[model samples]
Target chain A: MLIGRPSDITASEITPATVFRKRRALIKAAGLGTMMAWSGLSLGEEPKTKIQDYSKSSYGQEEKLTSYRDITTYNNFYEFGTGKEQPAENVGQFKTTPWTVSIEGEVLKPRKLGIEELMKLAPLEERIYRMRCVEGWSMVIPWVGIPLSSLVKLAQPTGNAKFVELISAADPATMPGVRAPILDWPYVEALRLDEAMHSLTILAVGLYGEILPAQNGAPVRLVVPWKYGFKGGKSIVRIRFVEKMPQTTWMRAAPREYGFYANVNPTVDHPRWSQASERRIGGNVFSRRTPTLMFNGYADQVAQLYAGMDLRKHF
Target chain B: MAPTSIAWIKRGIFLLALGPLIRLFWLGFTDQLGANPVEFIEHSTGTWALVALLLSLAVTPLRLLFNMGWLVSLRRMLGLFMFFYACLHFLAYLWLDHWFDWAGIGADIIKHPYVLVGFLALILSIPLAVTSTDAMIRKLKRRWKTLHLLAYPVAILGVLHYLWLVKKDISQPLIYALILFILLLIRLYYRLKLRRV
Candidate 1:
């Protein structure tokens, strides 16, 4: 139960965007075209793009950034595969180019936005945030994206819309894990309308000064830092605004284990394991286990969203 | 059995039983333990303990069905190896996880039912491991046979320990459960047959 976190991953480096495209091209040339546009499929860049870190004193920023390898490699993207290493190895060829996110359902301006349009809508900023997984392993990652509020404003949700539902891309042909019945395919996660519109919530497009590596949710993915990692669905395909609370994937899969709020509360333990502490990922072999923070240490900004609600129940 | 043949059989099984420990050391040395080494070590050791425990249980059926007395000689080593790995598994949790936080550890034991069973299984194994000596066997002949029967419930508790801890994927633990069920069936079938005879 007390596993140690490592300091920074040092395995295979993320395949650079150019190299990835060339590989996809080579695979196509070799009659493996079906594996095209996966992982590092980049839409054209925004003009004169620059990424800035949203570093602050009170943030749960670790002194050392988790190695890019660990952040990208060890993931819970079951779409690609089930093992921790499965997503890292299998997501290399997931077609993300020509991808579209449908922003419909309860929004006044329902529309489909191309990847380029999505990236350009808001300037991407790098927020080095600490990510705590429901599995009790945690990491500090620098995510580059725009605020979810900005995107929600663009969608123009109707007055009655009370929640934001996100659906991810889960193609059985490409994502082999979808073949297995592990939580309903094409994973769905949701947020209360205010939580979705919170400034801290972002639609992350990139990380480590480049487009997001495929394993870390390529093209576009949600980043609700306060919630558990699974709540942040990767390789998103849909964003729906609904009047009632949408049933999220984990909650639907195991109602007792995963609550809708999924807030990082140490007191509310998963039925199988305690949430009191987590292993920090990266660094030493015997990395120390530290106490998990409330709201994953984002209490200052997001606590008000649940000021009156009982988190243990919602969780 | 001749003295030389008996020595060879015991020695061979003893070295072969060290497989998991050897592989774990190799993985640790090569930095192949993956993202979480503590968990990797804990799981590997615990799984191997279950395997050894189940295999040791299979010995009686193997001996009875095949009428092979030699298989009985392998049981003591296999059963002790189960305890060997069980000790490592418990220590990994006690040292690596709790880090001597007696208060926290005590509270955790009471809090998690799965941990309680796992803890009880480890405590119960000590008597079995300690009394597995040749001298103890001679001192308490019929009683030794009856006392070792304690392994039956211990195996079920061990299987329950595994089945409870898993999150979503019960397949891994279920596989262990299936094997335990088959082993128990074989024993019950043989016991009824022998009683009828």
Candidate 2:
């Protein structure tokens, strides 16, 4: 989704020479600031104090922060491109201002919520959580958004609101990858109502204190921390509360590979790959790969909910 | 050919096969492979496997299309490279992802469609690689050709496995699909022409 710059920046603010000079100075200042900040560090100093709080969380406290542009722009969304920086570079063309999320299915108040209204519902909160991709790399994102359950409640779901389904925006003009039927365009994700109500499920609007960069699901997106990152569908434009389990985009494409319950558990091996361990995002290359926790290390809070069911069978 | 030269050629092939393995160790040691070394390793190995498979498939076409007979010599080496990469890809998944969780792995083999296809492709390629030697080829004769036909299905399954693994994007897999389609069409046209003749 495109985040338009203010008229001053886009239309006219200063002469080209002055603009270039100012940009150069800003960049120089930023570099100097980083050097000064690093020099201040002592061997005994707490790692958290070394970097900005938000950046600290995403780049583990001890890990050195990569280039801001690299960290912000590069993403693993192969739909856009494979390189980490491809999405940020390619997604600028996505039109996000005139966006509307369609609220349909089992909701009592089925209506489209404009982007502005959606933002007004909840004050943004900065949440630092680990984001593990199925591909094996991970990142810690300080997401800024409101609880997803709050939005689900705003729609006033009916008694049968057992599941919540999210669908991504699909426009081949902008998302060239949509031209191919790799997945039913408009990627879909669902969560049981109880899971949706969990505080960890957020309807993210921003990250790193700025409106989320386009590559990182600009405008609005879901952030289900405990589940694999793909389950948190991006570039979202539709929300459907339903009685039965909706056909999730991935599960629909390959049900056997992607399960309805995509909870992070080391024990559950992906058909071709194992789930026993994960690379902690932002860690050093040689950092020991840690064992994946059941429910992404949130089992104490969420495991009881799945008590009676056999995980292997359900998975 | 002299015995010394023949031994040298065989040694060269074996050493060339070690290229991917050495790069993997280097990346793992230096931390240049990204945050998850195992994943980076697995993905790199999988990609090499795909490239090697494509190269192996190209051998026959190259030989037929250009009459480059020497290209035939590289076929076995390319096919072996494909097997090497496939083994590394599987090992990464088994050692790092599964941690020898056989029950989970067994269940996954049965339950996951993409995994089943990928595993099947790997299994099917085994006999083809084993019987790739000239002596084995001569021994098996007509049966060898039938068994080697499995490469076509293996390629299709490899593409399918990739298609399913990707969550949203299909562009990469689509590219592979287009190339494989062209190769298969070429094979089909030649077969039809020969039959008519």
Candidate 3:
């Protein structure tokens, strides 16, 4: 399914640069500035992001959030490009408006929905989630979106629907990396039906309380905090509920390396790298890598999802 | 070329070869290394090591192709520079990336094929670097020529290290592999021509 930006927000609605800068200055003067202000580290000028109202949730409330610059700039949305910085640099022309997503296969109420309809399905919640990449790096991002469970409830899946596949957009006009066979076009990821219905699984629309940037999978993307970051398919185009476990893009590309579960388990190391520890993305060179937590420290919330299964075998 | 002129050129090339490290330090001080500073440092050092290795490998072919006997004097410096960057790259992985966690490092080396190959390449380069001095080279004589042939395997392993490290989009590593291939092919052609003569 193809999902675009919410229909309500228009070009004129974006805050003017002058006003945005002035407001930022005021926030700085008021001593209510963000991490960059306190750290005295220059991570370049923060991008002018579109802000939206989102109710704060308790998820990752105690954890320090990664800087907005790092969160946006250091992305792995391969559709834009393969390099971490390429997504932000190459997403200039990526259009997210007028997008629609089709929710089909094994759903009783399978229907297509515009990006706005999806946004309005539930109230936006700002969930601070620890996103861990399979490459042994991580970030604590304050994501703004509704839970995927809300949308699944709306779809009213049939009893036979055992898994749900999340497919990404692969428009060659904007997504330059799709031209190369780096990965199968239209990146796909899947989760067991129960895993999809978990409350922690969110359909992220924005991050840092702003409209999602194209690099960070603007409009709509999956945010499965318990799994490696790659499992959260960016810029989703379709959601297919199926009876059998669906093969994913990474699985097709390198089956031995990437697994269907892709769960964040420190004990089960990736074939090429140790998953025991992850370099916190915003940390300086001297900072010690933090030990990776079970289920990314969301074990209390997600471990039960894989209770009986061997993560190593699945991984 | 005059010995004096060549000596001056060697000095110039030494400073020029130091450019990558200087640039790295400048970027670090300027806070321009982006989000993951360690990764940026690691990638930069690793890339320069390979580049220097390729340049050192090219010296023989380039000198033979141009019939410039004076070029052989510079090969030692280039090879040493490659060793220098490779050391820095390994340090970045050990100190910066893994923080001297020997257990973790050992596990990583054993678990990953790419890491194993890279580690092997660096380990194999040590003897060449140690025996690089004029005294050792003069003492070893004929055996030194045979021993220094280790350069070919080191270069091949360096290229493979990069080729295997990447997940997909092997374009960058592929380019390095192609250059290494052509460099080896040129040397083989020269060897065949010498036999014919």
Candidate 4:
């Protein structure tokens, strides 16, 4: 049996050509009107904020993308709620417009950029990346965003900067989950400076060629393909460059179960579940488990980022 | 109560116990099991098993509290339902979740504490399920009661399995834990009062 092979994904084809064409048309016609029509609709019929004019990247172009419906509904955005379906159901009232992200700490240029300014930092690219969750499920999603390196370079971080800490919005007025103390408030995640600047790392503003739904981290969120899904903090409010590794929310919650670098390692088992194999989300119940890959099948591109470090120790 | 009414009540409880399984099949056939159907099936079966097990444990305390001796007759049926759902839960995990990979299943049972506890609870319940028949109960009247004491441990193990399985949100499992605690406390209270008498 070929375990963790790229061919595991090849068995399924990408979303059909006609749907792709319709998506392209939708992207072309996206405007301020679509943004206004984004509220009070069920996830099945939710009008997505269609992203305009993003260049398609070479990453995972041949892979089958998870359906837009599944991607929008099945999420781990704990700010909205912890249940997979709760985020979509509870996100109707969340307001993402007029958003601002403060970029500071150890950077020569400290400034607060509005959501639009962040999107304009560099040309957005649609990169289909395989996302593996710590709960042993995986999905291939086409995310539209600027590379994290572009924004970090723009910030002009000083030599003292060693790590980047990303913080998610946690307003009790808007987010119901924040009322209960799940994992300390304002979900925080961090990455090493090198990892943040890697080409594979991006701040995703949209997915499936649509402006990100509130459930799927609308406006802007980090997307680190090789790491577990939680590494990507959603609906981010602040990006701070720090000299020391920031204590991430999950790490603080359970230091033994979650680690600083949540890289997708099949050999390393989670305390409660196996990390060796993942159920591809879009398939039916009969779909056989697909073996998880080393660095989630991007080993060649990202292996050098942690050459000498022990993944088992870090994970 | 009259025998016919008692029979009707048992029938009602029986159908009520089957509701979750019927709903599962209905959802499965209608293609509404959601994104991760294997997990959905596994979760549904496991939760039903826990619910039935807790209900079975509640029979005695409820009977005493309400002064209704007839509730004792329903205990076996509730217990059998618990076993039935537990079997389905294990089958789903073994077949749907792991696809009959014995090595993987075996390793999971041995490696994770939650899996091990769940497996142990299922294994221990087998004898209670088999000896539930009237003939077996009559043959070993005194021994039968001792053997059925396994239910307490099984309930404890089931709750532990759930408590350990959750990632961070212990809310669901904590509710189960609270229910189990209250039931056990009621039994303890009765035992102490009987000893004093």
Evaluate model 3: give its TM-score.
0.91
Q: Candidate 4: which pairs clash?
A: none
Model 2: residue A161 alpha-carbon error in angstroms: 3.5
Instruction: Look at candidate 1 and tell me the lDDT of residue B128.
Output: 95
TM-score of chain B taken alone, every candidate: 0.94, 0.89, 0.98, 0.98
- Which digits, one per residue and each the tens of the lDDT, describe model 3 over residues A19-62? 55676787789877685353322222336455466798988988
Task: Identify the leading candidate in terms of DockQ.
Answer: 3
lDDT of 1 at B18: 92
Q: What's the lDDT for residue A32 in model 3?
A: 74
Q: What is the per-residue lDDT of model 2 for residues A1-315, given as tens digits with 9 covering 90 to 100?
A: 332332212111212223343544676777876654433322111112111222222213443333233345447554465556456556746877888988898888999999878877766566776776675556667677778877888889999889999888878888766766767767788999889989778888776555766677867889887788888888789999999998887788878778887888778777756677666655543355567777876687688768998888767
User: Which is superior by lDDT, 1 or 2?
Assistant: 1
> Which digits, one per residue and each the tens of the lDDT, describe model 3 over residues B28-145?
8877788899999999999999998999899999988999888889999999999999999999999998889999899889989899999999998999999999999999999999
TM-score of 2: 0.66
Question: Would you list the C-alpha lDDT of every candidate in the order shown?
Answer: 0.81, 0.72, 0.87, 0.89
Q: Whole-model lDDT, candidate 2?
A: 0.72
| CAPRI level of candidate 1 | acceptable
User: Which residue ranges in model 3 land beyond 4 Å of their true spot?
Assistant: A1-51
For candidate 4 chain B, the 10 contiguous residues with the lowest summed lDDT are B26-35
Q: Across residues B1-197, which tens digit of lDDT does each residue of candidate 4 receive? A: 78888899999999999999999888778777888989998999899899989999999999878988888888999999999999999999999999999999989999999999999999999999999999999999899999999999999999999999988899999999999999999999999999999
Per-chain TM-score of chain A in candidate 1 equals 0.82
True-contact fraction in model 2 equals 0.28
TM-score, every prediction: 0.87, 0.66, 0.91, 0.93
